[model samples]
Target: NITTDTLTIAGAGLISTAMSGDTLTISTTATADQNLWATFNADTGTTTANTTTDTLTVSGGTGISTSITGDILTITTPALLNVVEDGTPVLGGNLDVGASSLVKSTNVILSFSSGGEAAVNWTDISTALTGSGPIIRSVGADTNVDLVLDTKGTGDIDVSTNKIVNVVNPTANQDAATKNYVDTTTATTAQGTLADTALQNIVEDGSPQLGAQLDVAGNGLGDGTNLLLDFVEDASAVNHIEIENEATGSGPIIRAVGADTNIDLKLTPKGTGAISVADATNYETNVTADDDIPNKKFCDDTYAPLHDTINAQTGTTYTLVLTDDGKLVTMNNASANTLTIPTDASVAFPIGTRIDVMMIGVGVTTVTGDTGVTGCARLAEQGILIGRR
Candidate 1:
């Protein structure tokens, strides 16, 4: 049996009792005036008439039951002193992050509140603290404990200061153009480069000329010296250096300007001579002017046929020499002019020479063929005569 506001001893001992605010004063004798009650050996006391309103108090306690789900550390069994904080919790003593690991669950947030609402909520630092952070052991401790350098996603962890500071960004990702090299953007590939064409770029202070963009000529990145235009290949490799007109056709001639124009483009060879044309006489070490073409072949360059489109009235005789590649000769009779030809011996045209006679004049402009030559004179009016003579 249990009772409140009274005390009873198991052994034959005197009991004393007094009522206070929320404390019951009981003595070993029934004298009714004892402030402090101390339990002695072999003395078991009980209060009868028990109800749920009865209270039991313990003075000092340790190793009480505790549970932790996330940051809310709850005490299941009451401790000797239970402190609850409805407002801001003021730490009266130093908080020791004990030797145990301060582990945090995934995505667990540590929120800072002001005026009952969270002003700033820090997202998951579990990986940042545990993963990247280091561990240090004390002088005599068994294991190590991690000292987290709160590595938020915004900045890098400052190793020197052992804290998370802003990352020192490379020249890229900066809005200004003050950097010499951008570490962010990648270099551009050639845009449909010709097999023989070389690439070029312009630069200043080791940076690209046009920031991160390529020019119209598809020349980007560092200076043109970054890549040289040296043509190199094996014997069968027919490498050509061509000047482009645009993306589609040929452009202006690429010429050596200023004082450099006088220097000859001397091709150093392996077995024979300097520069060869059509496998003919190979030139020696130096050319004619040491720069100019040394007696080029009698064949013409890649140019159109050179002849008079008008009639030949001033000259008494006409002469033509047949080249390896053929030529197109146009003879238009001018007004009132009769074109004459010399004898077959004086005019000496090759046997396979092709003659084109086109009469475009309204007047009767007569043309005399080679005198003393056994050939038929076939002339057409308002037409072109094409035959091999």
Candidate 2:
């Protein structure tokens, strides 16, 4: 039993007390669970074990100072941020490293490595390739292959041999000859007995045809027909030039386009008021009573044989006189001798026509038995021009 007025507990914080006369017993087994103090009075209840053990632990609460066991909290500075595992961590978490930090499962395949030391910085291609060892290539040819180079550090580049290609350069060679070409070895050379003799004779006679021999048909020469006469436009066709002789009141009309119904182009009438047209029905005809134009006389007989119009001569002196003022005469001497024609010597010949005077005298000294020397002149009175010896 204990007797006291008041009881207080400090340090260990345990107390038991009773009123001045009331009995108080000290019991170690029973105690209050708080920081408390008790007072006893004469008439009040007895007090025992009023002060108790400190049971307000404050382990986890809003306003409390808590500490962890085995943790060195010696008022250290704040820590830097640490990368968390799968879960995100705030700024002040400890940097804890577990046993197998970065793990790839046994059954899983990893294409690339992770968590290695950073490579050294380098610029040269040889340095980079050497450092990264052999890299694994896709092993097959891919059309859209990409070349990825390390932009940051040294690394190797792996390429497939299938990606290589060959570059070809163009060259030229001689090919087959074309159609118009005459291959030198295969082209034919022409030769004939009679033809060669004829060609030699022509050359000796100073008359080699060569390529200049005119093609009678192709060149429209010596084809036995005049090319102009064959392609003559019909006089009756529109705009075709038509020749008409319309004399003013005369003979069975020379020729005309009827009386005068649009006779724009009319030929001047000839003398005698006559128009001897080949056909009277084909041409509209007329006549002029007194026309002054001369009527050209054309012989119906074919041109005279050139030999008949020519006469050979041996004498030296010859005189020529023009019968008509407008008549023309040509004397050609191919005898290789000087020819002198004695005109009045005062009569000046009109221009435009030629008066060819040649020398066909005895060849200075005549060569005996020369057939060509028995001279004769050649001429064409009308059309058949001839050369005579």
At residue 111, give the lDDT of candidate 1. Answer: 26
In order, the Cα lDDT scores of the candidates are 0.41, 0.34
For model 2, the superposed segments whose C-alpha errors exceed 4 Å read 1-75, 81-311, 323-348, 358-389
* lDDT digits (tens) for residues 157-251 of candidate 2: 54555442232322334433432222222222332223333334443565454434344675432234322222224555443232333346743
Q: Estimate each model's TM-score.
A: 0.22, 0.16
Q: After superposition on all CA atoms, how large is the RMSD of candidate 1?
A: 21.2
Scanning candidate 1 in windows of ten residues, the lowest lDDT window is 297-306
Name the regions of candidate 1 deviating beyond 4 angstroms: 1-79, 83-86, 102-228, 233-389
